[model samples]
Target: MIKIYHNPRCSKSRQGLSILEASGKEFEIIKYLEKELTSKELLSIISKLGIKPMDLIRKNEAIWKSEYKGKTLSDQEIIEAMLKHPKLIERPIVINEDKATIGRPPENILNII
Candidate 1:
């Protein structure tokens, strides 16, 4: 099944969800903030995205700027930070089978779904 890690308050996330709905393919929505992702779960998503853990972070978030900016952190440390502050995670990560993509432009989801 396809899954979307979404934040309803984020415009980009909402756009992504709309795209998925329009696509007419079945998908699951994971409200990561409400459910909270574990370190292992987040790590697995990052792996599917074929990106470094830091690459999946919302670097401009206030929490990132205040707590983790300009720091040389290990991949595990960065993942831990995201777990502690889920807001630091980038929104609308869509996973289809073993493939995943960050729906920054919303259209990006079309490539996967």
Candidate 2:
């Protein structure tokens, strides 16, 4: 089954969900905002993404700017920030089995799915 970490308010996230819907594949939606992810869950996602913690952050979000900008943070610290602020996470992360993708252009999902 496919799983998407989705933020419903984000247009890109919505687009990514649409792609999954169109594919007709079985999938689960993790509304990270409402449900909130655990430290372990976030870490697992970062691992599956094959990206540095910073790479998974939504740097442009206001919360990140006001709270975390211009300060050096370790990977663990960054992960902590994201867990404390789910809006700081990059959206529409799609996982299919062991492989995962960040749906930026939203089309990136096609490669893995």
Candidate 3:
């Protein structure tokens, strides 16, 4: 099944959701803000996206700027930060089996879906 790690408040996230909806394919919408991702699950997603932990972060988020920005961090520390502050996670990550992509343009999701 396809799964979308979604933040409903984000326009890009909403746009990604719309794409899924228009596709008429069954998919799971994970309201990640409401249901936090566990470390194991997060790591799996990062691996699937083929990106470093830092690449998955929303660097502009106030929490990241105030707490994590300009500081050196290991992959685990960055993962911990995202776990502690879910808002720091990039929006609308779509996962289909072993493949995943961040929906920055929202259209990026179309590739894997």
Candidate 4:
């Protein structure tokens, strides 16, 4: 099954969702902010994305700048910060079975789905 960690307020996330809708393939939308992810779940996502935990962080978010920026953190620490501040997580992460991608460009989802 395909799943998307979406933030409706984000235009890019909306676009990604639109793409999924247009594809006519069934998928699940995880309104991540509304239903926070557990540390283990987030870790699994990071693993499927084939990237480091930090790669999934939205570093430009105010919470990141005010609290997490300029601080050297381990992978676990970064994941903890994301758990504490779900807004710090990047939007529209699409996962399909073992493959996943951060849909910053929106179109990247097409490749995986």
Q: List per-prediction Cα lDDT, in the order shown.
A: 0.93, 0.95, 0.94, 0.94
Writing each residue's lDDT as its tens digit, candidate 1 over 1-113 gives 99999999999999999999999999999999999898789989999999999898888899899989999999989999999999999988999999999999889999998
TM-score of each: 0.98, 0.98, 0.98, 0.98
Residue range 70-89, candidate 4, lDDT tens digits: 99999999999999999999
Global local distance difference test of model 3: 0.94
- RMSD for each model, in Å, please? 0.6, 0.6, 0.5, 0.6
- Give one clash count per candidate, in the order shown: 0, 0, 0, 0
Number of clashes in model 3? 0
lDDT of candidate 2 over 1-113, digit per residue (tens): 89999999999999999999999999999999999899999988999999999999999999999999999999999999999999999999999999999999999999998
Q: How accurate locally is residue 59 in candidate 1, as Cα lDDT from 0 to 100?
A: 87
* lDDT-best of 1 and 3: 3
Q: lDDT tens digits, residues 44-100, model 3?
A: 999999999999999889999898889999999999999999999998999999999
List candidate 3 segments past 4 Å from native: none
Cα RMSD for predicted model 3 = 0.5
- Ten-residue stretch with the least lDDT total in model 3: 59-68
Residue 72 in model 4: shift from native, Å? 0.8
